[model samples]
Target chain A: MTQPTAAVLLIGDELLSGRTRDINLQQIAQYLEPIGIPVRECRTVPDIEEEIVAAVNALRAKYTYVFTTGGIGPTHDDITADAIAAAFGTGISEHPEVLAEMAERYKAMNTDFTPARRRMARIPHGAKIVKNPVSGAPGFQMENVFTMAGVPQIARAMLEDIGPRLEGGARVHKVQLRGPGLREGDLAEPLGAIAKAYPDVSIGSYPWYLGTGDNGVALVARSTDTVRLETVRGELEALMRGLGVEPIPDPL
Target chain B: MTQPTAAVLLIGDELLSGRTRDINLQQIAQYLEPIGIPVRECRTVPDIEEEIVAAVNALRAKYTYVFTTGGIGPTHDDITADAIAAAFGTGISEHPEVLAEMAERYKAMNTDFTPARRRMARIPHGAKIVKNPVSGAPGFQMENVFTMAGVPQIARAMLEDIGPRLEGGARVHKVQLRGPGLREGDLAEPLGAIAKAYPDVSIGSYPWYLGTGDNGVALVARSTDTVRLETVRGELEALMRGLGVEPIPDPL
Candidate 1:
């Protein structure tokens, strides 16, 4: 099977405006990696209908799965559900099940179920419900696209429900090696040789600096083959020893 | 004149694999926000040539400016330069100025200038230098695209040189209001009314949760018009007070 890949569509003006730092991309990527469905691409777009629709369509067509977060709230600016519906050319309306459940919850809390709150019941036609235990506003699964809340904690909670729906591939393994006195320039030659020798593995050279000068280099090798990952780790350690820069235990 | 907008392309396999959390997007967005060139869209793709080339072309064509971070280091995985050249359909070669400077620096540090180290000197044809004070391997500026180092500090430093090169539009103003016991369900009606009243302004409602339940709602209104921004702020505060929920001083 061709390895299953995923794409994330982050819809919100807050993310693009620099007012809020996005923690969702990393959270989603991390959550998916262990499931053997790596996130290949991620896009953050403002809360505009055309842009959201275009992005949703583009990403849904390409990846095995597409996840969108944000703009699915009880406000005028929360246009994600409508945008998703437009992208798939499907009709959207309030679901009786969700509306009844939400209304009961509000009544239990002694709060009136206003029309704005009722807006949360809107769901695209033919879409499956992605349950929201944290809040009453449920996200929908339209085909391969999984829509969730923008709030980090709620988005995170939604993943528990989503995890079972995915079909994961062979697990990808990663090994990290760090050198205190080493830099990218110092390790580039030998690391390139190792990388060339092992064509199946993906190696990355990351150098950390203290603004003034270099602090160290973090070398990470990733592959689905566990044996090759371990072998690459040995080679990485040997290369660091050859350079006279003892490998640090952890540099993160 | 139409407002100038920016798009950020973050390239790295580490980010896709969830090995590293990206900070460049927020950094670039915050930097450009004050300059009046708001970041409209942002995409993150792994360190692959064709993907990089495609993203570069798509973003460069759509936005006023394109900023890319990552895959510029001296390693086997660093193919951003080649990908950028392919996108622009230009030849890339080692620049004498960059080569000489890097060689001198390596020599002073008592390091050998290997072929891998020499790889850092390559630059695309007709591209101007984006000075990297942190490292000797300077990034390049091709047409409207500004390429910079993947390292956070280096990317931050490169912004100082880039700020003067951009032509910014009218500065956007923002006002934020936080309600302690208020929820989206409480404020949605009035907030929607306000958003409709002020078509030129963009209003956003963000609800923070503590996993179990809602903590509060952060209502933000943004516009280029300062007077409208203040009016929205007042309206937002009144909306919170009308529900008998006191507005919080800070909720970020």
Candidate 2:
């Protein structure tokens, strides 16, 4: 069976401006991988309405699932909910259940339910709420697109709530082999031949420099089929041995 | 004058598969910002030829500059150089100078100059070389797009070489005010008013939790005009005071 594919849309000017480093995309990718949905593409666009809407429309159409993080705060720059509504050509207003929850939370904190705080209740019409356990403000899901908060803790909470609902495909298995003191150039020919021999698997070589003297290349092989994956991995080991190098399992 | 805008295309499957958290986008954004160039959008695509070519074409067309990282190493999966050549509809072959440099580096390290290592010397037709001070393999520039290594240190070195060649616009100035023990909802209305008051400046509110019981919001104001930026910052501080909160300068 073909693996399910997903895309991530990270919306924020802070991320693109270098004021904030994004942590949500990596978390989302790792979350989806074991569930058999791999993130195929990820895009980080500014909080502009047109850019957000365009990215949402394009990604939603192409992937089985699309996840968006950021811009769901109670401020003027927080325009993600409205943009998502615009992308779907739907109306948006304060969701009644979400408003009730927010009102209760604010009351417990001895705070007023101001219009700005109420803004968090805004949900695209016909969308289901994705509960945020950390903060009272809940994210919403419209079809296949899951819109969550930009903050790492909140986004992680939202993902935990959404995880059980997803239907996954075959999980991909991966194996790594490290060639210490070996150059990629020496292994390139055999690596290429091994990759060609196993068309079903994806083979990647990554170089690493550990301090001043320690440096080597890591060979990673991934596939959904365990048998084929192991077979290809054995061949990779043999190839490294032929090149006069011992292959060690990557510590990572 | 309008600031020059740029886009970054990060090409690697390891990024999408959650094997590698990208450090290049943030580095690129921070590098370009002080130079008066802001990265407006960034996209990460797996090592697929069509996706890389398509993103290169699209981003290069929209932004003043495009920076692509990864897929330039000497491995079979490193197809970025070839994909870039295809993106510009040009031929690619080993550039003589680059080949000579790689050959010398490999010889000094007592390594063979294998065909795989030679792959790093490939350059698109007519593109100028971007020097890689960390690694012997040089990156290239084709019109508005600057291709660099995936490794952070190498990419950093390439940016150093490319910086002097870029023509920048007005550098944006920014100021920040943090309102301790203040909620975003309370600041939203006044923040909106301030944003409307300074239409040319971009104002953003970010919420933070201090791990203790403390939580507050940070207000950031950005503009190309230093005088206007200061004026807007003062207004923001006054607005916070009016809301019965003291505004502190952000530690960052």
Query: Each model's TM-score, in the order given?
Result: 0.96, 0.97
* Deviation (Å) of A210 in candidate 1: 5.3
Candidate 1 local lDDT, A1-252, one digit each (tens): 678999999999988887778888889998998889999999999999999999999999999999999999998889999999999999999998999999999999898898998988999999999888887789889999999999887888899899999999888888878887687777898899999999999888887766555578889888999999889989999999999988865633
Location of the lowest summed lDDT over 10 successive residues in candidate 1 chain B: B243-252
Mind giving the per-residue lDDT tens digits that candidate 1 earns over B1-252?
689999999999888777788889989998998878999999999988999999999999999999999988888999999999999999999999999999999899788898888888999999999888876789989999999998888899998888899999888877777876678887899899999998998898988766455588888888899998888888888899998977764532
TM-score for chain B in model 1: 0.95
TM-score of 1: 0.96
- Number of the top candidate by TM-score? 2
Stretches of candidate 1 off by over 4 Å are: A210-214, A248-252, B210-214, B246-252
DockQ of every candidate structure: 0.68, 0.75
Clashing pairs in 1: none
Top model number, lDDT: 2
